[model samples]
Each structure stands twice: as structure tokens, then as C-alpha cells.
Target: MPGLSRRGERMPPSPIRKLVPLAEDAKRRGVRVHHVNIGQPDIESPEEFLEALRDPGTRIVPYGHSAGLWEYRDGLVEYYARFGIRVASDEIVVTTGGSEAIIFAFLALADPGDEVIVPEPFYTNYNGFAVEAGVTLVPVTCRIEDGFRLPPLSALETRITSRTRAILICNPNNPTGYVYSREELEALRDLVVERDLFLLSDEVYREFVFDGAAAHSVLHLEGIGDRGVLLDSISKRYSVCGARLGCLVTRNRDLLSAALRLGQARLCAPTLEQKAARRALDASPEYLEQVLDEYRARRDAVFEELAGIEGVLAVKPKGAFYTVVRLPVEDAEAFARWLLTDFQVEGETVMIAPAAGFYATPGLGRDEVRIAFVRKVPEMRRAMRILKLGLQAYRGAPARAGDRAGP
Candidate 1:
């Protein structure tokens, strides 16, 4: 038999889902597992979104334009306008998901072996996408002490080389849930402009910010519109992950054309999803407000419980539904697997994503784990209790006084 190609061998398994067997084993053993691993929200999709699909006025289930339905695209224009991101419908190319939007941006802007700088401990799927594109991911570390704020602009400068093609950022970032301040975004803007690099902003969680924090879009930045590519989705915004409808928006005609060509190759994204997303754009802000309130409650509960844990350190996230906690254990991956495989509290356990997967550098994030606050408040509190109990069960020395609680 022929051996697999080198590229095939290079593909990395999804770190998020790799521990499923352990979870299944735990379940088979009669343990109730509280999942804090992935960011699948428990919120209901808006009624209007479903109603659009149920109306069924059209006779044909034809493929919409490769770029997506004009009405859908136009709705996105208005959707973005609410946040002061001005762009025409023609500038948008709808993709299968924000996952596809990232791939499309990479295909449009990068050649094999080119570099994209992403802050360390970023969204783990980014590693997968970079591997598939054969692009190098240069990571700039952001200290958890600073709530994983983008490291100083100087840190980003050291990673740039001639092959550097883009800078990718997740605003109200994944894994860490750090919402970049306006100053931080401006600092990034200056660097991207100076280096003549593409700026890719993943704003999928734009609506989930808390504590009166507002999200700033790179598209709204003054002169960088030509260099900016905004990756967005209705999945998180509308709690309709199954819809899998996302769009890549840019003011750069050249980039949009290149992305459109890639979209053409795929024919078109899901037609019904596009219609649902179109209706989702018209949903009242109140629907999102209700979801945000629930997430905020969950976040508060998780933060408080983590604070009470003897050896765990976590910051209060300003946005998104994830919290990165520093654990007392030496290797978070080992501890995470042990939690699902061996440890239990009242015949229940919590499954978490090992923080190492979020980092590009080997051996970093070894003592950290990411917990998603997607469950209801009561469940999140229970999960946190189990997490604390698991830590107590681990055979490690206690954390130092001030170190256990961050700055």
C-alpha cells in the first residue's frame, strides 16, 4: 500500500475534541460530565431566524450566488453599520463559517511558507488552519497577568520578517477572553500599517461583551480599511452554530476578488443558512441582550468559584465566554485527561481544554487550562466546584499567596 503524503501526516488533530474518548469513558462509568471544553453556547436561536426558514415561500432550493444572496449581503451591510463599520454589500463574500472565512483570507493573502503573526494562546483552530495553508504562525506572547492584553507593539516587531503577510487577532479573544482596548487596537493598527501587512480581525463574539465594554472594529479605524479583513459569523451572535454562515468583509477590492474566486470554487455556502442569517440580522437587540445576561451570570459564577480555589488563578473576563485559569498542576494536559479519566466529585467531573493547544510554542501553557462559561450559572458553579476538588486531589504543592491571585 502507498504511504500517506507528507502534508497528510502534518495535519494535527483538533486539540479541543481530542479528549472525547476519555469523556465517553467517564460517561460509561456513570459520571455526569460538565463540559467546559468548547464554546457551544446553550442559548436558543432567535424565533425570527427559524421563522424565515419555515415560511417556505420560494419554490426552488437553488444555490444562491457564490458570494451569497444579495439580500443577505445587504443585511450584513446594515448589521455592520450598527457598529459603525461602513462597507458596501459588494465587499462581502459569505463563506461556510468563520472557519472558512479564515481559510479564505489565508488563501487570498498568503503563499505557502508565508508568515501570519497571531498572539500566543490564541484560538486553537488557527494552528490547524495555518498547518493546512502551509503558513508559519509567529506567536507574540501576552502575559495572563495583564489579562492577556496584546503585548507591547515592540513584541510584535521582533516577529516580522519579509515573509510576514498578515496579523491575525481575535477581539474579545478566544481561550483568554481578553477584550482589547481602543488603545491596544490602535497600537496594532500602527504596526500593520508600518509593515504593510494584512490585519485580520475575528469578531465572532462581538455581541457577548460585558461590564459595559464596547467592541471596536478594525474596519472603523481611520486609514487601515484597505488593509483590514473582518471575519464575522452569525453562529455566535445568534446562537445558531448549526447555520454555519459567516462572511469575510474587506474594503480592499483585490482581496475581496481573491476571496470570491475561492468561494466560487466551493460553489456556494448553504442556501437556507444564508436566509436564516439574513433574518438573524434583523433580530432585535433584546434577544442578544438576554443571552449576554446569562453568559455574564455564568462568567461571574465561574470567576468567583475559581477565586476560591486554593491553587487556581483566573481573571474576570471582560468579554466572551472563556476563562484561562492557571492551575497548580505541572502539566495541564495530563491533569485535564486525569480529570475526565480518573477524578470525580459526587460521581461527576468537569472536562476542560488544555491550554497548551492554544499556544504555538511547545511546552508553554503547561500549567494552564481554558474553561468555557457556556453552561448555565448553576451548572457552571457545580463544574467549578468539581474543578477545585480535582485540584485538591492532585499531588502538587500549594501555590504561593499572591501568585494564586493575579495582578
Candidate 2:
């Protein structure tokens, strides 16, 4: 048999999905594993969108266009206009998902061995995309103590080289869930403009802002309009992850032209999903409001419960449904595995993604784990109970603690 290519060897398994076999093994042993690892929400998709999919009159399942249905793209333009982002349908190219948008953006704006500056502890899949695109990810450290704010603009300046092509941000970010304030967005705007670098904003969680927080878009910034790329998706907004609908929005004509070429190669994203996405674009504000409220309540419950556990530090997440908790354990990966394989409460255990995967730097996030508060309140409470007990048990083992928390 032939072996895989060098790129295949360089690629690592998705850290999020790497533990699936263990989770399945636990299930085989009759253990009810409460999954807090992934961000797939349990909320219902909008009824109007579902009805659109179920309509008997629906037809034309064939591929619509390389750039997606013209109607859906136009609807998305209107959707953004509501948020003060002015753009035409021509500026948007529908993608299979935001995942593809990221890849296409990199392919369009960067070359092999080029570099992109990203804040540390960002979405892990960015690393995978960087690897696939054959680009280097230049990371600037952002501490959780600071709520993962953009590291000082000066810190980012230090990482820039001639090869640095862009700066990627996930506003109201994943894992830490820190929403960038307008001031911070302006600071980034100034920096990107001064450096002449591309500003790629991943706004998939744009509608999930809590506590009356508003999301700032780089595309909304004045001078940076020609250099910014807005990655939008209907997955989180409509709780329809399987729809696989996303868009790449920009006023940069050259970038859009290049990205369109890439889109043409893939043919078109799903046709039916594009129609459903058009319906989603016109979904009721009340449906999204209710979903936001549910997520906020779950965030509060997780924060409060984690606070009660000694030696656990959890930042109050402002936008997304994830919380990064700093554990007292020596190695979070080992501890996470132990929770799934060795520890159980009432024949159940909590599954979480080790924070190390979220960072590009080696040895960082060693004592941390990213937990998604996606389950219902009752399930979240049960998972927290199991985690609290696991922490206590791990602390009691003298060899494990080694004088860190030993009696």
C-alpha cells in the first residue's frame, strides 16, 4: 500500500474529535457521558426555516450557482444592512460552511509559507486551516486574566514580518467567549490599516451576544473596508449546523474575485440548504432572542457552579456558549482523559476539550480545559457535580498533587 503524503503526516487529528472513541467506550460500559467538549447547540432551529424545507412545493435540488442561490446572497446582504454593514450581493459568496470561508480566504489572500497573526488561544481549527493552506500561524499571547482581549497592539506589531498577510479574529470568541468592545475593535482597525494587513473577522456567533452587548464588525469600520473579510454563517444563528451554509463578505473587489474562482472550483454549496438559509435570514427576531436568553442562563449556571468548586477559575463568558476553566491539575489532557476513563460519579462523567488544543504555542493552556455550556440547565448542573467530585478525588491523591494541594 502507498503511504500518505507529507502534508497528511503533518496534520494532527482534531483534538475535539480525538476523544470520541473514549466517549464511545464509556457509553459501551453503560456510563452516561455528559459532553461539554463541542459547541453544537441543543436549541431548536427556527420554525419558518423548517417549514421552508418541508414545503411540498419545494423543488430544484440541483446545484444553483457556483456563488450559491442569487436570492440567498441578496437576502444575506439585507441581513447585514440591518447591522449597519452596507454591501451588495456581489460582495458575498456562499460557502459550504464558515469552515470553507476560512480556507478560501487563506487561499485567496495568502501563499504557501505566508504567515497570519492570530491571538493565542483562538479557535483551534484555525491552526488546521493554516496547516492545510501551507501557511504559518504567528500567535500573540492573550491572557485569560485579561478576558483574552487583543494583546496590546504593540505585541501584535512584534510578530509582523513581510510574510504576515492577515490578522484573524473571532469576535465574542470561542472558548473564552470575550466580546471585543468598540474601543478594542477601533484599536485593531488602526493597527490593520497602519500595517496594510487583511482583517478577517469570524462573526458566526454575532447574534449570541449577552447582557446587551453589541458586536462590532471590522467591515463596519471606515477605512479598513477595502481590506476586511467578514465570515458569516447560519449555523449558530439558526441552530442548524447541518445546513452547512456560510458566506464570505467583503468590499475588497480583488479578494472577492479570487475567492469566486475558488468557489467555482467547488461548484456550489448545497442548494436546498441555500433556500432554507434564505428563510433563516428572514427569521423572527424573537426566535433568536429566546435562544440568546437560554444561552445566557446556561452560562450563568456554569459560571456559578464552577465558582463553588475550589481551585477552579472560570471567566464569565460574554457572547458564545463556551467557558475556559483553569484547573489546578498538572496536565489538563491527562486529567481530561482520566475523567473519561477512570473517574465516574453515579456511573457518569463529564467530557471536556483540553485547552492546549486551543493554542498554537507549546505547553500553554496546560492547566485549562474548554467547556461548552450547550446542554440544558439540569444536564449542565449534573456535569458540574461530576467535575467537582473529580477535582476533589484528583487532589486527594498525594502522588498526583505532589505537595501542590496535599494535606
Candidate 3:
């Protein structure tokens, strides 16, 4: 048999989805599972998106321009302008998903063995993308006690080196929903300009901010067009995670040209989805406001429930649909696995993502879990109840590896 490359061997499994067999076995035994592990929202995808697919209009479902369909790119122009961002449609290169946009950004800006600094407890898939791009991730640790805010600029500067090519940030971050402020963006703008580095902002959750908080985009920084890459998606906004359509927007001529070549290699994003996304982009601001209200209610229910628990600790998230919870147990992965294999409350259990994988440094986030509030309020209430009981039972009896003790 042929062997795989070192890159293949080095790839780590997703913390969001590693324990499937045990979950399947639990279900086979008639035990219910409340899945809070991933970010798949229960909200409905926009009706306009579906209506766009009703008509083919063409004899052939053809490939679009590598830069993207003129109409779709034009729709994005209108979309960004609403956010106070000014950009030409020519500057946008539509990709397969936000996942691909991250890859393209790394490929365009960095050589092999280059570094990109990110705040710790970031999106877990970033590690996978970094490995594929042959770039190193330098983490600037942020404490949960501080609500995962960006560390001091001085702390971030200490992580920088000559090889550091970019700083990647997730606005209203995943795993830890810390929304960046205008002042923070200004600080990063100064840092990137002073250091001659690039700023890659993941703004997929731009419209999901809660508590009357607003998201500050790197593109909003004046005169930083030469050093800004905006990676965006309609997935979360419209609850169409399977759409697999996203784009990289930048005014940096060099970055734009290089990213276009990379986009050409992939050909183009899904044709039908692009059409649907165009309609999605045109959705009324009222539609988003109603959707946000639902998320805000669920967020409050989950946060309040967790707060009532004796040993569980978490800060109220200002944005996004997730929060990193500091659990009472030492090994959250073990606790997570145990919840599937051993514990059940009234024939039901909850699945959570262990937070360890969200950090690059060892032993960090060992006793934490990242929970997504993507489900309805009632389901969230039940999941939180199960979690409270699970923590109490697991703390009293820490399940050793291979121990399948029942709750």
C-alpha cells in the first residue's frame, strides 16, 4: 500500500465531530441526544433563495466567470455598500465557501513556513487550513474571564516576527463569541500598517451580534485597503450552511490578482447556489432582525440556565451563537465522550465540542467546552438541564478511559 504525505498524517480530527460511533450506538439503544456540538442552525433558509432555484432559465447550467457572475458580484456591491464599505465588484473573487476564502488568503499572502497570528479559542477549522497552506498559527491567548476580548496590542506584537505575514480574526468569533469593537479594529489597523502585514477578517457572523452590539469590520478602516482581506459568507446569515458559497474581497491589487489565479484553479462556486445567494443578499433587513430576535432569546435562555449551575462558568456572549464554557471536570473531552457512552437523563443526552482543539497551545482549554445555541429555546432548555446534571454526576465519579459507567 502507498503511504500518505506528512501533511496527511499531521492533520487533526475536528473537535466538533470526532465521536460519531458512540453517538450512533447510543441512538441504536433508543437514547436521545441533544446535539450542541456543531453550528448547524435550526432557523429556516430564506424563501427567496428557494424561489431563485425554481427557474432554470438556461439550456445548460453553465460555469460562471472565475471572479463570479456579474449579477451576483453586483449584488455583493450593494450588500457591502449598506455596511458602509465601498468596493468595486471587480475586487470580489467568489469561492467555494468561507473555508476556501481562508485558504486562498493564506496562499496569496504567505510562503511555506510563514506565520499568521490569531487570538486563541478561534474557529477550529483554522488549524486545518493553516496546515494545508503550510503556515504556522501563532496564538495570542485571551482569557474567558475577560470575555475573550483581543489581548493588548503589545501582547499581540510579542507574537509577531519577520515571518508573520498576516493576522486572522473572526468577528463575533466562533467557539467564543467575542465581538470586536471599532476601537479594536482601529488598533489592528495601526498594527498591520506599522508592521506592513495583512489583516484577514472573517465577518460571516456580522449580522448575528446580540445585546445591541455592532460588529466592526477591518474594511471599515480607512486607507488600509492595501492590507485588508475580507472573507465573508451568507451561510450563517441566511441559515443556508450547505450553500457552500462565499467570496474574498480586497482592494489590494496584488492580493486581488493572486487570489483570482487561485479562484481560476477551482473554476467557480456552485452556479445554482450563487443565483439563490443573490436573492438571499437582497432579503429585507426586517427578515434578519426577526431571525436575530430568535437567536437572542435562545442565547439568553442557555446563558441563564448555565449560570444557575453550581460549578459551570461562562461569560455572557455579546454576539454569535456560541460561548466557551469552563466545566468543573478536568478533561472535557473525556466528559464529552462519557456523556454519550454512559450518561442519559430520561433517555436523552447532550453532545458538546471540547474546547481544547480551538487553541494551538498544549493543555489550554482542557477543562472547557464550546456550546452552540443554534437550536430552539425549548431544546436549549432541555440540553442545559441535562448538562447541569451530567456535570454533577461526572464530577462525583470521573469516568476513567474505557469506563462505561451508567448515570
Provide the clashing-pair count of each candidate structure. Answer: 0, 0, 0
2 or 3, greater by lDDT: 3
Off by over 4 Å in 2: 56-60, 398-407
Tens digits of per-residue lDDT, candidate 2, 1-407, equal 99988778888778888888899999999999999999899999998789888982555568678877899988988899999999999999999999999999999999999999998798899988888999899988888788777777899999999999999999879878989889888888898889999999999999889888898998888788788899978888899999898999999999889888999998999988888878877778899889988999898888778889988887787898888888988788877887898889989999999999899999899889999988999899889989999889877765553224432
The regions of model 3 sitting more than 4 angstroms off are: 398-407
Evaluate model 1: give its lDDT. 0.88
Residues 44-93 of candidate 1: C-alpha lDDT, one tens digit per residue: 89988899889846888888799989999998888888888899999999
Tell me how candidate 3 scores on lDDT.
Answer: 0.90
Alpha-carbon TM-score of each model against the true structure: 0.96, 0.97, 0.97
Model 3 poorest 10 in a row by lDDT: 398-407
Candidate 3 backbone overlaps, count: 0
Best by lDDT: 3
Cα lDDT, all candidates = 0.88, 0.87, 0.90
RMSD over all Cα atoms, model 1: 3.3
lDDT score for residue 162 of model 1: 98
